[model samples]
Target: MSLLDACGAGSSSPATAGGGTTAVLNMPFLEDMQVPDPDIMYEGEGVQVMHAVYDGLAQYKPGTNEPVPLLAESWEISTDQLTYTFKLRPNVKFHDGTIADAASWVAGFKRRAAINQGPAYMVAGIKEAVAKDPTTLVVHLKTPNNAFLHYLACPWHPFAVSPTAVRKHAVGGDLAQKWLQTHDAGTGAYTIKEFVPGNYYLLEKFPGYWGGDVAYDQIRITITPSVSTQELQLQQGQFDVITKGLPIPDVLKYQKNPDYEVPVTLGGTGNAIWINPNKPMFADRKLRQALVQAIDRTPVVQTSYGGLVPVQKGFWIDKLFPPNLDPISDTFDTAPLQALVAKLPDKNVDLAWGADGGAPVQQMAELVQTQLAAVGLNVTVRQLPTAQVFDLANQPQAKRPDLFIDWLGGDALHLDTVLRIMLRTGAKPLNLFSFTYPELDKLMDEAILQPTTDKMNAMYVEATKFVMDQAIFVPLCSQPFPIIARNYLTGIVQDSDLPEVIYADKIGRKLS
Candidate 1:
């Protein structure tokens, strides 16, 4: 059977009109080197390269969080929702001419579990993955999770590789991980033609790809360390696509230019003030509530975000969440904060943040410092690398900060990802807040099992409200993610399930 016949085609982007030509899609890179192994890739550049060269069981529908079948034609969830059976697309072959089947998936999952690197968290819930038959793949989970399918759709995890090719290239039992860094393997639309770490990489379209047509024959990604250089390149028409790192201020400057199309989209990730309850002053729920209420978000949103992003109404970004889930009203009041602050012996706050969130986090922290001062709180701001802040929080209880301004990159499709990563007991080590409540944990677990959307939303609402009452953290603004494209570039999908990712396969130059 043909590849398309094996795996039923899910959806196809509209073919470019007229006649198309080979176009160069230039992308950016922040890291010095991309981890070539898909199971271990966590950085943005690595993810981009992996998605370009690999296909997961599923992928998010373009511009939406809804999961759609990709390598797997369809999947069935058991009554308990712990077992997922996937029907493989039969004709799918990796770039190396090896068939990708249920066995390939099993091998990939086992490899991911064995490698145990940055993206290891993606498969942490899986109890086992087995090939029930040649085309049938069954994955058994430790517990029922509604979002497990969405997890499979994520670019970071469970993409099938050419196990035969991988094994052939394996050295010292490394599963070809070391070799894959400089090579390509998978059934993605593009194959790596050339790779130079910290410099650039080139992708050529795979002719045997079953995912309809790929507009661009080739994609060249250049390493850009500065946003200014990206902006300059965009203005000079040196690059067709700029994949992130250009600031909002620079995006604003290019908004009026006819040469570029600056798309301002709401990202799935959220920024917030993570309060550490282990600290003496913040241990008081009243004090935490007061701090949130006292701070005015208007100026922070206006100045820090340049009024580009919305002042978050609730913890979740509005685009990805149901409207009813947001708080009815977020009121700013100082009386409660003033009274609470007057009673506290220690009013000094150490605000720590990383460069990941860039100027917005720093500006938001400074604004918060000023806001709390009006209520008799003294704030000291500190800046550190992203790694150090997470390291300190993950260390012993005594090492956590009083408060940290940071961004939470939530799963775009489900709220459970946020709750599981930030609020659950085991998540305390990774989260800024070190406290866990039994009642909240119960609500979270129950919400996971809810069979209906209404019931699930109700439980989630209750859980969110419970967290709001505790005031463990303050939800700030959603980051403004703007994509800059040359006006001649066509077939660019501005919205994506993963806010940080932009698929390179769909890009095509406008046919004239």
Candidate 2:
């Protein structure tokens, strides 16, 4: 299939350019705009900007999940799969006009490791990145990591940054974190023209882009935090595309217009309510199972999400790597759950979540509260902004909520990422739930080090079943990213791997 076909982009809407030159995208909320640096960002909105402003050693091909040549012209893996050698594309230059060579990449990798921030785990396995020669970059791994390429292809990893730029901006060996928070460093399709945290940002096409011509000369990203406001702006012809965060009802309303197409695809983290087993309330397996059994996902999917999203019965890993070994049954039975509830001395519990997932999470949490209450359990829902929720999650065990309704979307397509980052005992500090499952931890370690895909798949399958049996978290649904694009827009490709990010490099207007 062609790239557009792979991206699922050919709709029947009549084509005509609304804006003569600029293509505008509207996002409901931005976690922050400190996007010039990749190490600190955890949100997918940051990834969207990274896709436009930086070039990785390798990247997933546009519209597909397969890794293709990006900064590296070609690459070879060692027989043991512990070593990688990449051949850099010749004549590439960073936005600062410095040559991007093997040494450039080596400097970036070392700097990223030193900073040891949010995405450092991606390259943490790398023992060293050496400059064998001007065009040759060699990487030595601590172990055989099956997901190495997928990690590099993810936006969270360290992309090629100009060594000269970093040196010039450094103060007290800070690695230019302050300057890069709002500046450009790599060779990408677009350059940062303007950035203003939560308000809006503008990007201009870089004529010197090594890949090729970028479709949009300028991309203006406006932060419209209200679903209603974004829908109105889209209708008023102010936005060429309304990005994710539009409520499902608003998305459904816009689908009726032949002038627009709301493309919905499975993306981001699978939605779930995390149970801190450390808490006394959720300490019992039966009690945790009871909470899961009480939730009827039918209304949450149909009424809240308008059926745009699918019910996620299996772990998110099942969506990508699956024979779906031991998929968690979605069958709801409240009898055992009620019996367990009767045994508890205190039935009052707190359900914490954010308003970030749009209307679906809010409605689901409310519905869960009402349903659980029907079974003679008192549930209190605590709502917080996205940042504050994360803050609470990182707090001490005593202060954390009983449960947090959120999604733990691995940044890449590998099961190792999902297992190690989210499921492995003591892995997720952000969630602040210190869980100790020695056997499960051993299984996860073996899964990542397994040299073969078949063996790796088997281990991950067993791990998924173990996690579900424990009822550590209640799996909800796989998030469906909704995009409303103007009918005239062509070359709109959503990355199959990084579905949260939308590519504008190939986006252009269609002639009627």
Per-residue lDDT of model 1, residues 1-512, tens digit only: 33321221101111222335344566666544455677766543456778889899987776667788888999898888889999988888899888888988888888888887655656777898898887899999887777787677765657888899888999999999988888877899999999888788888889998676787677777777666786665555455666565655666787887756777766566678888888888888888887778777778777877768767776676645686567635568899989988887887888877655665677888888888887888889988554565456468766666888877655436777677667777563355555678898898788877777788888889888888898877777767767777676666664355554666677655544
Q: Itemize residue pairs with steric clashes in candidate 2.
A: none
lDDT of 2 by residue, 153-245 (tens): 765767888999999999889998888877888788888888888887777778888878865667777766677776665565656676666
lDDT of each: 0.73, 0.74
For every candidate structure, what is the RMSD over all alpha carbons to the true structure, in angstroms? 7.2, 5.0
Candidate 1 whole-model C-alpha lDDT, 0 to 1: 0.73
Lowest lDDT 10-residue stretch of candidate 1: 5-14
lDDT, candidate 2, at 24: 41
